[model samples]
Target: MEATVASLVEHGWAGTTTTAVAQRAGVSRGAQLHHYPTRAELVIAAVQYIGAARIAEIREQATDLPTGPARTAAVLDMLARVCTGPLFHAALELWTAARTDPDVRAAVVPLEAVIGRESHRLTVELLGADESRPGVREAVQQTLDLIRGLGLADLLTDDGARRRALLADWARHLDARLGS
Candidate 1:
């Protein structure tokens, strides 16, 4: 699964094949085929696997988030890091493929819905966001969208310094909006 994600991040959807994953995984073609017989199955399963793993990692890290004023910035920073990692890159490859491929779209839509829901729930929890309050839910969703947009921008260039600046400013605005 790690090799599959690595392939997606390095070579993208067009180059991630069962054979390539097999070779990268240091497994025989027969073994790779036995586990996942087709490219769609392999890539989809790899994304699912890594997505779950990364979410679990984020959940664990959330425990260490600072209390009080700094927590909002910390949560934003952590979520941004999640959006910038290998899982997000691998998922981006799948998303691009899904744009023109119906079968891939069918698979990716549901997968992303689940991931998106979990991410929103996690973010709300991390920031102690009161979604019951008017506009608070939209604020959380907007924050996720903003980070995702930043992640998309990162695919074309290394904009870490700029991204950090933007996110830091966003954190302040968000904290004020949320009354955090």
Candidate 2:
């Protein structure tokens, strides 16, 4: 799966093949086909493997934080740490695949929905509420958009400060909007 995913990432989905993945994985093409049978199956498995890895990372980062703003900060900060590498790369490749391929889009959409729900769940938990106020969605979008934008920026730039500022700013915004 790692070899398949890396190959698909380096070469687009259309360029990757079972034979190629087998070659990269040092396995027989027959074995690869036996396992995956089709490109769509392989792509779906690759996405799932990547998403599970990401979820584990999120769980690890959130393990130490108390629920509320601290937990939210921790989650966002961890995302900041990974946004430039695998996370960003995965997002780019999958989203690009999604644009042209319905099978890929269908595979990715549910995973995205899961992440979206998880984000909202974390936000609600952080705010100590069952539901976010109207501002919560906007705050999340702004933060996610900023993180995505900055992921490609200079690595030497102050990401910690930037993430911290965003977290603080989002908290204030949510608090003001929620009247809490």
Candidate 3:
């Protein structure tokens, strides 16, 4: 799965062949085929696998999060890291592929919906957000969208300094809104 995600990040959707993944993983082509019979299946499964792993990692990290004013900033920082990580890159590749490929789109749309919901839920939990309040839910979703845009921008250039500055501003606004 690591090899598959790495392939997607490095080579993109068109280049991430099962044979290539097998080669990178040091496994036989037959072995790879045994698990994923088609490229769509392989790509979809890889994205799902890596996405789940990344979410698990974020949950584990959330345990030691700081308290008080700094906590919101820390949560934003953690979310930024996640949005820029390999899993997001892999998902981006799949999304690009899905734009023109109906089969891939059929698979990725629901998969992304699930992942996005999970990510949103996790963010709300990590930030101790109360969605019952006015605009709180939209604020959280906007935070994810903003971070995703930053992640997309980072794909071309570093975008780190700018991302940090923007996220800091966002964290302040979010902290006030969420009362975290």
lDDT of 2 at 92: 66
Q: What is model 3's C-alpha RMSD?
A: 1.5
Model 1 C-alpha lDDT per residue in residues 1-180, reported as the tens digit of each score? 989889988999889878888999999998988988887787678768866876886898798899989999899888888888887888888888889988778778887788888989999999899888888898999999999999888877897999999989999999878876
TM-score, candidate 3, is: 0.92
Which one wins on TM-score?
A: 1
**TM-score winner between candidates 1 and 3:** 1
Note each model's CA RMSD in angstroms: 1.4, 3.8, 1.5
Q: Give the poorly placed runs of model 3, Cα more than 4 Å off.
A: none
**What is the per-residue lDDT of model 2 for residues 1-180, given as tens digits with 9 covering 90 to 100?**
788668765776666777788899999878888998888898889888877766666566655666554545565566566566655566567778898889999999998888767755654554454334566566666656666666756244556666667656765665555455
Rank list by lDDT? 1, 3, 2
Model 3: per-residue Cα lDDT over 1-180, one tens digit each: 999888988999888888888999999988888988887788678767876777787787688889987999999888888778877888788788889999888877887787788988999888889999999999999999999899999998899999999999999899888866
TM-score of each: 0.93, 0.70, 0.92
> Given candidate 3, what's the lDDT at residue 15?
89
- Runs in model 2 deviating more than 4 A are 8-15, 65-73, 126-134, 152-180
lDDT of each: 0.86, 0.68, 0.86
Clashing pairs in 1: none
